[model samples]
Target: MPQIAIGMPVFNNQETLARSIDSVLQQTYGDFVLIISDDGSTDGTWAICEYYARVDSRVLIFRQEANLRYMNFKFVLDQSQTEFFCWLAGDDYYSCFFLEKCISVLNHDASVVCSVPKCQFTAPAGNLSLAEGTFPIVQDEIDMRVTQYLYCPSDNTRMYGLFRSEVLRDSFPPRGFHAYDWALSAQTLCFGKHQEIDEVLIYREKTKRALYTGAVLRDERGLLKQLFPVFRMSVWLLRQKKFPRRRGVVRALIWLNLVKHMEYVSNVHPDFYERSRFFYTYLKKRL
Candidate 1:
């Protein structure tokens, strides 16, 4: 079995840190190291991490003096030394065989750079529930799925995935991107292929503050800015003629952004509509 490195960035997640750590420690695949980056957490998160590190040599803990977002996550990932890597959020837990199954796919296919597994979402106050039936089983599938989701606004299927360490290291998430996972997934698809496993290996915690949640939609301007990269990437992919399975979806994505830009201007920034007209025009031409 190849060695795996799991990078986890933690903030003030005292309520779920212990459970997340325990799930990693209990993984059936034992040849793995856990790198925990505490981004200046104010709660008892650090203390809990320290306790686990003291007992388990596999757990390596680091502390960031300030609260950095996904950029800090990239920093910690850079310090890992393993053939495979995956991130587990401070508030999420993984199945004992999560790493094993993902690694198996990578080991089987040299061209595949990542493996995305099915996930279960759970609210802090409620029981864990199945969020979706399955995610894309390959990179082309992810591209198509992402495009459809963008246009129709449905629950996504490609969120929880394990990536090749080198691929992730080469194309780190851009700072200020809404979520590292989105940028990382885009990069992984561009550089290499991906395998989709149907097993629900990750249990995602749906808290108000969780970065992946749709809460950013409340900030219309922020949401539009964040989505710009996804649109940009889609345009690039279309030019490259990659993921032909996703061509239709990509076209829809472009139009979706155009619609969103119009809505934003009509509702919030009517004054800037003239300047933003270029964005809408560009998207319309592509669509």
Candidate 2:
């Protein structure tokens, strides 16, 4: 099996799919398999993917019968048998050395379950800017990692990091409309350590994307469930026996993060704040 398995899930990303695939094919570390899952794109994404697959033996492609979005991510994960795995968004691309450096970090440290690099965001207006790095995860404590992940103001760049495949298998699956990465981050911390490399290795396209739409968001119950996924996540974690020995500490941390998450979301997405606040109130009553 290849040393690393990269999962690229595409859904109507025709404009940038080729560039994203090219970035992976150009990785300095050559001993890796790129699995591109076209999430039922009606556009020319599959055609572009097919071209790359034909030319490069390292590239394999699949197409879902329907658009799965977050669920498509799980398809690639199920196919990987390598030591390390990562999910690359359809529109994002990585630097040439991203794989080489991340693989080296995992090989050198048995305790480290993930290696994340800094992120750079690119906009259609030709503007570029840096995002968060591994600095937020500088501390070694697993509990600290979980709390900081909840409180820290950072994108989900770490979720795209090279991870030990076994830990990925053990962690919780993606859930809810948003912040699935945040939920998974908690699970990863419970399993092992995560190291962040200072260099910016991934470029995220600043696209206004919504993971949920249509009938799902139209229903009040569905919207509420999607808005307050942390509650489901917390209950699941407890059932899985993932909380640390000091259960009270874990509960307190969750409450603290819940409040901070509310504040953070309100500031970042003001329009969604009132709805989130309503769901949070509903969450409190449910708890």
Candidate 3:
């Protein structure tokens, strides 16, 4: 079997699908499988995946009946049979040395569960800027990593890093609601610390932030659940028994982060935070 497994989940991403596939196929470390799952894409995405599978022996492809959203991510990762694993969004592309560098980190340190590189955000209009790195997650202390990760605003690019396949499988919990990615991330911290590479090598396309659109929630059912999302997400994360000893500490941290999250969101996304911007307004007046 190959040393690494890469899952690429695509849904109506025909425009950027080939670019992502090409980036993977161009990796300097080529001993890996690129698993592509078409999540009921109506566009030419399936055709693109099929085309790559035919041309590259390393590429494997599958198609889903419906838009499974985050489940599509799980589906691709489930089919993996490799020591190292990572997920590459259909809209994103990585540097040729990405896999090589990440694998080196994991090989050199058994304690590191994942190796994440700094990501460079790109827009359709060609604007580009490097995302900040140095997440407090590198610490071996589980509570420190989990609390810092939960409290701070991340670029949401760490999940795209190379993970030890066993830890990757264990980190993922059963899907429960919107922002399930955030929950999985917190859970990953429970297992081990993640190493972040300082180089800006990952090129992630900016996904839309429109709340009601398919951008935030996949199925319409998630709309109601998004109300009070911070607590809902925390409740889901706290249910896991991964860190039973740290539950009390984690609980306090969650509450603190929840308030901070509300304030952060209201300031960063005031329009989506509602016209009242209650969190921003109320906190400002009180402070």
Candidate 4:
């Protein structure tokens, strides 16, 4: 069995599936299993996976019988989990040393649970831009680390980083909700430290998404759903029993940020602003 496992769950990603696989297979740290789960892709994604598996014994491929829309991410991880594990999105590719650098962090530091790399996102236009910051690596207090995570507007893409397999599984949520990745990271942070490597390793492909498409995955819809959401997040975190109660001051900061977010929304969507004001007024009256 390999010390590391790479789970690639893909569906109709023929345009980038081979690129993603090749990058992982060509990693400097070569002793790992590449598990590909095909979610009934009508495109050439399965053919690509098959070709790679034939060419490289380390590549293991599994295909679904039909287009089941199964939870492919967790499915691949369920197949096997070695000492370390990571999910490589079918559309994203990494630098050759990406694995070597990430595994090195895990190897040297027993205290660190996940080793995330700096990422550069690729726009559909083919332009590349480096992500501004990542989830911080606070070595000591869990609450403090979480505060840093909340305070800093960091990319949640760090969830794709390499992690201790057991820790990852243990941190997995019983059920997922909106902003669940934030919940996952906070839960994992409680267990041990997370280190973000300085090196730029992964090139994440950004999907073109339409605004207000009624997608459940989207965090925002309009003023009704978006109103004072950050403040609510603060309340939930402070009240939660799993972690220590964060400082009350956290809510105030969240409130301030909420104001800024509200302003941005108001400028971009005037109708949303009008609706939010009336809605908030109604709630205030009831209170």
Candidate 1 local Cα displacement, residue 21, angstroms: 0.5
lDDT per residue for candidate 2 within 1-287, as digits (tens), equals: 79999999899999998889999999999999999999889989999999999999999999899767776887888888998999999899999999999999989988888898888889888999887635446456666666666555356678899999989878846454344555676678777788888899999986444432322243225534534435555555555556453544465446644664565456546888886688877764543
- Candidates ranked by TM-score: 3, 2, 4, 1
Model 4 residue 127 distance off true place after TM-score fit, in angstroms: 2.2
lDDT of each: 0.69, 0.75, 0.77, 0.73
RMSD of 4: 5.0
Q: For model 1, how does the per-residue alpha-carbon lDDT over 147-245 read when each residue is reduced to its tens digit?
A: 544454323335456778888876664454433354445545655665678778888875443333343343224545644424544444444433444
Off by over 4 Å in 3: 133-136, 211-224, 244-287
Q: Which runs of model 1 end up more than 4 angstroms from their true locations?
A: 132-134, 137-159, 207-253, 259-287
Residue-wise C-alpha lDDT for candidate 4, range 149-174, written one tens digit per residue: 66554557778889898877776654
- TM-score of each candidate structure, all chains considered together: 0.74, 0.82, 0.85, 0.79
Q: Pick by TM-score: which candidate is best? A: 3
209 in model 3: Cα distance from truth in Å?
A: 3.2
Clash totals in order = 1, 0, 0, 0
Query: What is the TM-score of candidate 1?
Result: 0.74
